[model samples]
Target: MVAIHLTSSFLLIRHFIPFMKKKGWGRIVNISSINGLIAMPGKAPYCFMKHALIGLTKAVALETAENGITCNAVCPAYVETELVMKQIRDRANQNNISYEEMRVAALVGFLCSDEAGSVTGCAIPVDAGYTAR
Candidate 1:
């Protein structure tokens, strides 16, 4: 999955750079997760993959800067999406807790704070400041 994501992004950038250069402006935003920034127990693969995405974004941003192209990754924590619900369910099962309890705990642990918008090439933890504490 990581390979596919990275390869497709690279191919797209390669194909689009000429057009962007001609137009002299372009922005590429990659959606990453807070998990990409901080490692969580039992989620080694996710942590590894997200960190790789950040690295890829940084490398691409540097390579494309001269061409008026900017590549950035937006890291959001525990948004109220289906994916979050799935994670809640998984955690509930793994920890033998109620779904509601798991949900609240997850939110409290990972999604309770404002994001730092000024940081780049840095993991923006939208997980409610989970890393802050």
Candidate 2:
């Protein structure tokens, strides 16, 4: 889980950074969860990895800020992917809570574009206002 969530991103970033640096422009976006920002019961490993991912995003963003490269993480709550759907089902059953879907593609697209060149080192939440609570 650590490798899948955190180490893989680190390795990929390390591998691509030089190429991006040479090219003079790049965008590195990571998919994180609300767990990255807030803690929930019975999700320690997942939360830990996600939080580390945010930290990685910020650190890498700083490292490559001046090189026409940006790194950011999108922290969404229960996106509508298959794996997430399963988790949501399980969680809903366990806690008897309602569910909602959120998508990060548009924000990710914006982040990858020239308009967001000035935006870096951000853990932007796309949690349908759940973080507001």
Candidate 3:
């Protein structure tokens, strides 16, 4: 549980933050999930990690913002990736929504760009309106 979700982000930030600090331009995009903001039934571990990831992103954002670094998170719901289709095709189909894969990349790309210089600690959703409810 800790290794894949929690520890990995922590370690990556710890390892590379200094380099970014040295360069004076850094962007951190943590890929959270809709479950992080809204819980999903029977997906306790996944939800927990994503929720934790949100906290991590927020803290990291505050810690590094003044250093010309920005940390934001992309929260996508049921993106049409191979892993999602393979694992949750039945449930996703039950939701009656078509695939929305590009949204995730689009949000991440915006967060990484210079235009979003002041946008940090945000859990931007790319969920095809799933979280709108």
Candidate 4:
């Protein structure tokens, strides 16, 4: 989980940030989870990695902001992906609620665009208000 959520980002940033620095523009968007902002019962390891990912996003944002680069995270809710479905099945008895399918691609797209140049180091939630509770 650490490798998947943290190390991969670190490697990608280390690899590509040099080019971004040369070009003087870049955007790094990390797909975090709503769990990064909140907590789920019995998901300590997963939650820890997600939270660390947000921390990484912030640190990278600060490190590269002076070079016209922006780094942010989009924290979406359960999206019915195969991996999530497996977890859902394992916790079926615990959660009986349904989730509206909220799209995150648009938010990611915006974060990658010029309009969001000043929006670095944010963990914007696309969780259909789940974190509001």
Candidate 5:
């Protein structure tokens, strides 16, 4: 994940900075995760790596600010993706619960409203408000 995400981001900045320099404007949005902000019980590695990515985004943002390049990290908690469904299943298995139960427990009553968009420069908990409590 680090290689794919961080490495690619570094490469993009290296390769695209010249173009951005000529154009005088650019926006780079890195897809970070809420794990980067708040640690979970069983996802230490993911949390650590994502935190690192956030750091990278901040560094890049600072480096390119004078160049009119904006680098930011978008931290979404849990979107309804296939990979997330698999995680739900895994959680179900780990907790010995029904899939539906796990899904509800995973998502119900813990979501963020779209207006939360104002939050940035850190992880955004789109996890149905998982971190709210």
Candidate 6:
């Protein structure tokens, strides 16, 4: 997960940086997971990948900020998207909770806004305070 996701994002950004630099304004949001913020049992690969993504976001943001570019990561513990519904559902079942309770979508929305123009190099969590523990 770390190698694939990390390398792919780097490659994609490498190909696009020139264009965004030319425009003097850009925003790059990497959709990372709360695993990036903390650890859990039997989730080493995921945690490693997400942690790398946060590092990448910060590193890239620093390198690009001078050109009006902002790079950040949004760390979500669970969301009701089809992409990971099964995983969230399984977790919810194990925890004796409802999957519906995990459908969060905030950090992404915030980081994508014009008001977040100066909020670069951050891995803001959208995990319903999960990482606060």
TM-score per candidate: 0.63, 0.86, 0.84, 0.85, 0.65, 0.80
Q: Report every candidate's CA lDDT.
A: 0.61, 0.89, 0.84, 0.86, 0.63, 0.82
What tens digits encode model 4's per-residue C-alpha lDDT throughout 1-133? 8889889988998999999999999999998898889989999998999999999999999999999999999998755687787654444434443333355777889999999999999999876566897
Runs in model 6 deviating more than 4 A are: 83-106
Residues 1-133 of candidate 3 have per-residue lDDT tens digits of 8798889999999999999999998999998889889997899999999999999999999999988899998887756677777544555466665444434677788889999999999988776567898
- Where does candidate 6 clash, by residue pair? none
Tell me the tens digit of each residue's lDDT in model 5 across 1-133: 6787577878877898789768777666676777877889989878888888899877876777676666666666544478698876665676576666533222222222233223323334443344575
Worst lDDT 10-window in candidate 6 = 99-108
Off by over 4 Å in 1: 3-5, 83-123
The candidate that wins on TM-score is: 2
Ranking by lDDT: 2, 4, 3, 6, 5, 1
Write down the TM-score for model 5: 0.65
- The residue pairs in collision within model 3 are none
- The 10-residue segment with the lowest total lDDT in model 4: 92-101
Q: Estimate, for each residue in 19-47, the C-alpha lDDT of model 6 and write its tens digit.
A: 98999988888878888999999999888
RMSD of each: 7.8, 4.0, 2.8, 4.1, 7.5, 3.4
Question: Which regions in candidate 2 have their CA more than 4 angstroms from the true location?
Answer: 83-101
**How many clashing pairs per prediction, in order?**
5, 0, 0, 0, 4, 0
Candidate 1 lDDT, 43-100, residue by residue in tens: 8887777778888778877876776666666566554577578875665677576666
Candidates 3 and 6: which is better by TM-score? Answer: 3
Residue-level error in angstroms, candidate 1, position 114: 23
Q: What's the distance in Å from true for residue 26, model 6?
A: 0.1
